[model samples]
Target: MYQAKIMALLFVAGDQGIKEKDLADLLEIDRAALRQNVEQLKIKLINDEESGIMLSQYNSTYKLITKSEYSELLTKYFKTGLGTKLSQAALEVLSIVAYRQPITRIEVDEIRGVQSSGSINTLLARKLIKENGKKDVIGHPNLYVVTDEFFDYFGIKNIEELPKIEKFEDYKEE
Candidate 1:
C-alpha cells in the first residue's frame, strides 16, 4: 500500500518523471529498498488492466503516464485546460529556457542567481520544459528547452512570438 502512495505521487508528476535517486530521497529509503518498491509497483500495475495508467522507466527515471488507449480522454482534459498553474520561479526558468534553449541548469541559475532545480523540476513535471540533452561541459549537465506544450499553454504561435524584453525595460522606475 505504501508503494501505492508512491505511485500516486508519480502519477501526479506527469511525463517529466522522477529519478530513482530522487524517489529514494523522497521516500527516505535506501536504493535497494527503492528498487524493490519500484519492481513491486510495476508488477502490481501490470496485473491491473483497468488502472488506465502505467509505469515507464527511462535513464533511471520513472514516470507514471496514462496508457495510450486513454489518449482521447487525456486530450479532452488538455483542451479543457486541466493543467496546474506554475509558480513565479517556474515562469522565470521557462522564460530563460524559451529565450536560451538547450541551456544547462547552471546557466539558468547563473542568470537567475538562485538554485533553480525546484523550478526546473516543476516545469518539467508540467510538460512545459524538457530535457534537450547533456552539455559537453564537465559533469555533463542536462540542457533544457521548451516543449510545444509551452506554446499551447502561453497561446503563442512560436518561440519568436514571445513578448520582447524591451517592453519590460520601459517600465523601470529610473
Candidate 2:
C-alpha cells in the first residue's frame, strides 16, 4: 500500500521528474526506506509488462515513462477512434508549448498564472508534447516541445505551418 502511494506520487511527478530527497521528504520516509520502496516499485513496473509504462531514473530523479515497444500501438490508438479529447486547460498548455517550445513548466505556469502540472501530464500521455531535454538552468528543469504526433493530429507538416501570432491582432478590440 505504501509502495503504491509512492508510485502514484512518482507518476504524478511526470517528465519533470522528482529527486530522491524530495520524494523522501514528500513521503515523510527516511532515505533508506524510500530507496527500498523505489527498488520494489521498479521491479514491479518491470514485471508488469502489460502496463505499457515503466519507471525511469535520470540524474537521481525518477519519472514514469511509456515503454518503447508500445509506441506503435499508442500511435495507432490515437489515430484510430479512441474518443479522446483534450480539455481546455490541456489545449492552453499545448498552445503554449507549440508556440514557445523548449520552454519549462515554470515558464508555462508563469504565463498561465496557475499551476499546469495536470494539463501537462495529459498532453504528455496523449503524445502531443514531449520532454525535449532539461534546460541548462537551476534545477535543470525539463524543456517541453510539440511532438510528431502533434503535427499529425493538427495535419501540419511542420511547426512552420502553425499560424503566426501577428495574425491574431485583427481580433483585438480597439
Candidate 3:
C-alpha cells in the first residue's frame, strides 16, 4: 500500500521514466514484489476513470502521464514556476524537427536560417525533441527526433497523424 505511493512518486518525479529497479530501490524490495506493486498501480490508474492519469512504458521506463480529460488541471497543478512556456523560436525549431527528424542539429539550423543552438537547447530541455543518435556527418553531430512526449502533447498517437504540411506549388516544381 505505502509502496504504491512511493512508486508513484518515483514515476512522477523522473522526467524520462522509471525502471522497476528504481522503484525497488526506493522501497528496498525485491524484484517480484516491486513488479507486483507497479502492476497494481498501473491497473488502479487505468481503472480510476475519474483520476485522468495513466501509466506509460517507454524506453524501459514507466511514467505517470495525465490523460486528456485532465490535461488542463494537471498542467496547472504541475506547472513549474520556471517560465514554462515554449518560445516562438523554439516552436519553429520543434516544427522543423518533427517534419525532418533523425536530422542533425546543423540541418535544423539551416532550415531555421539561424544557429538555433539556443532554441534546440530549450526544446531538448522541454522534452519536445531528443537525441536519436550521431549523424554520419564529418563531426557526427547528434541527430535529434521528436519524442513520444511530443505526440502526447499534441494528443496524437504517432507523427504520421500530424496534419499534413502542404507543399507550395512553386516549391513542388522540378
Q: Which ten residues in a row have the lowest lDDT in candidate 1?
A: 8-17
lDDT of 3 by residue, 6-123 (tens): 5557654544456667767777888788777777877887888786667766765667777778767666765864556677777888888998888887898888786677678878
Query: Relative to the unseen true structure, what is the C-alpha lDDT of residue 133 in candidate 3, on a scale of 0 to 100?
Result: 82
Clashing pairs in 3: none
Q: Compared with the true structure, what per-residue lDDT tens digits does model 2 show for residues 1-174? A: 668877788876655678889898988999899888888888888899677787788888888888889889888987887848777788999999999998999999999997788789888888999999999988999999999999999999998899998998789676
**CA lDDT, every prediction?**
0.85, 0.87, 0.76
lDDT (C-alpha) at residue 12 in model 2: 67
Clashes, model 3: 0
| Clashes (N, CA, C under 3 Å) per candidate | 0, 0, 0
Candidate 2, which segments miss by more than 4 Å at Cα? 1-82
Q: What TM-score fits each model?
A: 0.54, 0.53, 0.50
Model 1: runs farther than 4 Å from truth?
A: 76-90, 97-105, 109-174
State the TM-score for model 2.
0.53
Q: How many angstroms is residue 49 displaced in model 2 relative to the true structure, after the best TM-score fit? A: 30
lDDT of 2: 0.87
Q: lDDT of model 1 at residue 40?
A: 88
